[model samples]
Target: MMYKSTLSVKKEIALHLLFWVIWVYFTLAVVDANGIHFAEMDLFSSTWCITYVVTFYVNYLFVLPKVFHPFKWIKAIAGLVVIFLFFAALRYFLEQFLTVQLFNVQNYNPGTGILYYIYDNTFYAARPIILSSAFWLIVLLVRLLDYNKYIIEEQKNTEIKFLKAQINPHFVFNTLNNIYSMVHFQSPNALPAIEKLSSIMRFTTYEAPRNFIRLGEELNYIHAYLELEELRHYDKSFVSWETTVQSDNHEIPPYLLSPLVENALKHGSYTAEIPIIIRLSCNDQQLDFEVINRIGNQKKDKLGGIGIDNLKNRLEILYPEKHTLQTTEQEGLFSAHLVIYFQ
Candidate 1:
């Protein structure tokens, strides 16, 4: 904790130094553009530079926070107005005194009226205030951007945790049901079913907790799941799987394809003579997947399924605008197509 705090302090100091260096350079350039020699302008430049620095910190550290709070608007505005007037008057007198006393420069007119003197001083002071306000706005913008980035990172972490929690429970429940059915029938595939379930459980418990996994690894998990489902259905159902993955090196969010496949198997019509078809194609840029199954006479509630809703939520969080998912039912057939674009 101490190390982190020390590092943060160092970073803040470095950033402040960098900003001041740039500010000085810009001020020098502007003075040079006005054909003013450095020796003659040194006092003028230094005075306003210090004035701007003071103004920026005063607004940034104190006034800005109050301004940001909507409930404190009246107090904040009143305070800001008072500060602005005070700084404006202070800058005018400071510059006048430094120029006249330190450099023996004289521009004051003793005969001038108080109102005219005040007006002239206020006009000169406005320049420093304007420059300070510009720097303060930049500081606010940088802080806002940093805050937005932190928020996005926190939201992403929360979404991944939620998805992982949902996936494990749903997957385990479905796989256990399949295993129970196999045991109840006293089928010869019961042992192999247990092995498949074990492998899937391992993947979900370990691999799926990660942010990303190789596409090939995910496909292998899907294969294991399909095999387990096949054992449960026995010879009563048929599945046709096809793939055209151009590379196994591609990475995707873990368990991304499992829910779609699970939904197909759970809701597909088993009595149909036509086999359920699942197709997956991938290239360097994108992945395309489709699952088509025969619909039974009893209409499957596709929209009402928790698995599908969970899948949609995960897709929205992970892929956002980078992927498309569509489901259609026509002529006793239900089809789900998904396309994901890689960055």
Candidate 2:
């Protein structure tokens, strides 16, 4: 924290110094005179530029921040007026008293009235303060954008964590129930189910925390899960899994594709004619996945659950406009089709 704050302060100081150096250089560039007269005028201009610098920094560093608050337009205007008066006073003292006393020279005639002198100086003195306000506004806008970006990223990470937390327990509870059923019956599949559960638990506990994993790794998890489901149903022929991947180098968010499969398994009617069909295809630029199953009348009402809802949230956050998910029921068939475009 201290290091970041110190770095920020250093950057601000550097920016201020650069601004002043550029301002002074440009002020000297437009002098339009030659030799001895130019030397006198150059000194005069440099002295006046110092006063302008003071005026600019005073307003920028102290006055503008205080006055540009909520319902403070009156204060802001008043602050500008005070800065203008302060600038006129500084110029008046320099041109009238100090220059006269030191070098017996003054830029203005001794007979010029104070009010007229001040009125004349307003146009010249206003430049620095106006630029200071502009500079301050630009800096404020940049900081606001940075802070907004920080806040959005933080919220996205928090939401992803929350969804993952919700998904893990929901998954573990369902799998544990499946294992309990096999154990209660004292079936030979109990040990295999326990092993499958161990593989799944390792994936969820260790690998799920990553933002993304290789496509093949996630596919392996899905394969293990499907095997576990087959053990649960005591029928290895109830699911048909197909994949056509040109390469396995692609990456995807962990556990993104499993909820659709889970929903289909929980609600699908298993028959020889219409077994649960899951198809996955991946290319260099896109991933296409579909889950099609015969809908059971008894489980149709429970079609959408926490898993699907959680998947929706994760998809919105992780993929945004780069993906599409469609779920529909047609002719006693429920299907979910998901496609994600890679860039």
TM-score of each: 0.79, 0.87
Report clash pairs, candidate 2: none
Q: Write the per-residue lDDT of candidate 2 for residues 1-343, one digit (tens) a residue.
A: 1112222667878888898777656655445555322233554686687788888889898888888765377898899889998888888788777888888888789799978898898998889889999998878777777777777887898899999888888888989999999999998999999999999999998889998988887887887888888897888888887989999779898888899888987888876567999999999889999999998978682447888899998999999999999988899898999999997
Number of clashes recorded per candidate: 0, 0
List model 1 lDDT by residue over 229-326, tens digit each: 88887763577879898898789988778777777777877543688788999998899989888876676826336667877888898888999999
Question: What do the candidate models score in CA lDDT, each in turn?
Answer: 0.75, 0.84
Assess candidate 2 and give its TM-score to the true structure: 0.87
Q: How close is candidate 1 to the true structure, as a TM-score?
A: 0.79
